[model samples]
Target: MFFFQGLTMGLAYVAPIGMQNLFVIHSALSHSLRRAIMTAFIVIFFDISLSLSCFYGIGTLLDHVTWLQAVILGVGTLLVLYIAYGMIRDIPAPISLKDQPASLRQTMSKACIVTWMNPQAILDGTMLLGAFRVTLPAAESTPFLTGVLLASGLWFLSLTGFVAAFRHAMTPRILRAINVLCGTVLMLYGLHLGYTFVQFFQI
Candidate 1:
């Protein structure tokens, strides 16, 4: 039960405009296959660790410091704003890599930076998921995290693989449509986050 719930929740949380999905999709089409798989693994590593931290560390912190929720909310809100700017400015699409992925050390370095720098992902994977996991009976949390890890890995890997199969179909028109949709959702979600922040802060 915990595993199933975790799998469903993880899929719901991860399928959106987060960095992991973007990297996988981009790499599958444009970067080396091995590099793309490595990126997905890096993302999964972060997700699992973040969830564990939330499970153990954040749960304890929040029990005492009610303001922790606000901090997470603020971080999430800010990320949405930053991404909104990028979308609204119609920033030129990233240049797709024509070269093979970097060596293992270089890939690891880049993956670390990308995984760590994404504030929204950090909050969702560690902070929110952690709190929820802590609420579960201790017997189930391990399986819960296992389910989440599997979901995260599968989502990214399958996303990249499926998109790669259609590499030629990712025309400019398609990319533009995706950008428009992503930008719209980012702005809407940011506004929602701001509203939630205000509502929770006042309580």
Candidate 2:
């Protein structure tokens, strides 16, 4: 039951085509298969780290801190809007393998930033995992967390695999359409978050 619960929750959190998913998809389509896999792994690492931090105690602390939440929401709203703007402006061209691609260090840094800076991801960890962790004993937490880790690893691997498989068949027009869709979604979500942030001040 714990395994399945963790798996379901993990899928629920990751199913959205948010910034992390889009970044992973872009990496898979435009880079070497190995590079794409590395990026996915880096994201998974961040997910695990953040989830564990929340499960341990940080989530509870965050819940009590209204100012911190406001700050996070404000910063997240801005960052997401910036990302949305970038996505809309930078149209995808026909992807080509470059002789000199991004270094592993650079790719890893980007993966870390996307995963960590994502406001939605942070909230999900603090609220969801934090709540769930309270329902289990310490011994059970490990197994539940293991299940979560498995789900994260599996999901990213499958995502990268699917994107890599179909990348060659995808035309530039299709890629551009996808970019537009992702940007629109991010913009809408950012607006929604901004509204939610405003609600925090209601007396």
Candidate 3:
């Protein structure tokens, strides 16, 4: 039951369009199948690692440290802005299959940064997962964690396949519009996070 519960929570959280999804879709649309798979795996790695850390009580430590929270918020906002800029200014032409500018190592690094630097991701792991973790029996914890990991991994794989399946139908115009939309949303999200951080300071 715990495993199923965790799986459900993971799917619910991951189904929404977010930075990780955006990158995965972009990779699927612009790169080879192998590269897209690699991106998905990289994202899953970060998701699981973060979840595990939070489950082990790291989230509680973070909550007690205002300066660390502020620093994370600041850095996350900046990274979101940077990613939004890339979305707006650096979108490549729609390609069915093309060589990506960065190698696998660079792609993996960017995936890690994007996954780790997003404040939402951190909060999701530390707060949401941590809360759920507290309610579970120690013996069930492993199953629950495995469920979370599986859910995230499956979602990424499905997302990659979904984007890849439709890659041929995406025209340059459509792709450009998608990029613009993603950038606008990301920029707004960053601004909101920044505002929240400032509000905390004011309080």
Best model per TM-score: 3
Weakest lDDT window of 10 consecutive positions for candidate 1 = 91-100
Q: Please state the error at residue 111 of candidate 3 in Å.
A: 1.8
Better of 1 and 2 by lDDT: 2
Q: On residues 1-203, what C-alpha lDDT tens digit does candidate 2 reach at each position?
A: 78887888888877777778877887787677878888889888887887787767775666788688788778777777777776667667676665224687877766665666666677777788888888888778877877887888888889999998888788888888877787788788778778878887773
Candidate 1 global CA lDDT score: 0.65
How many pairs collide in each candidate, listed in order?
A: 0, 0, 0
Q: Residues 10-81, candidate 1: write the lDDT tens digits.
A: 788778765556545545654555667777677678766666665566555655877776876676677666
Best by lDDT: 3
lDDT of 1 at 18: 59
Give the local distance difference test score of model 2.
0.77
User: What would the per-residue lDDT of candidate 3 be over residues 20-39, giving only the tens digit for each residue?
Assistant: 88888877877778888888
TM-score of each: 0.64, 0.85, 0.92
lDDT of the candidates, in the order given: 0.65, 0.77, 0.81
Candidate 1, after superposition: displacement of residue 69 in Å? 2.4
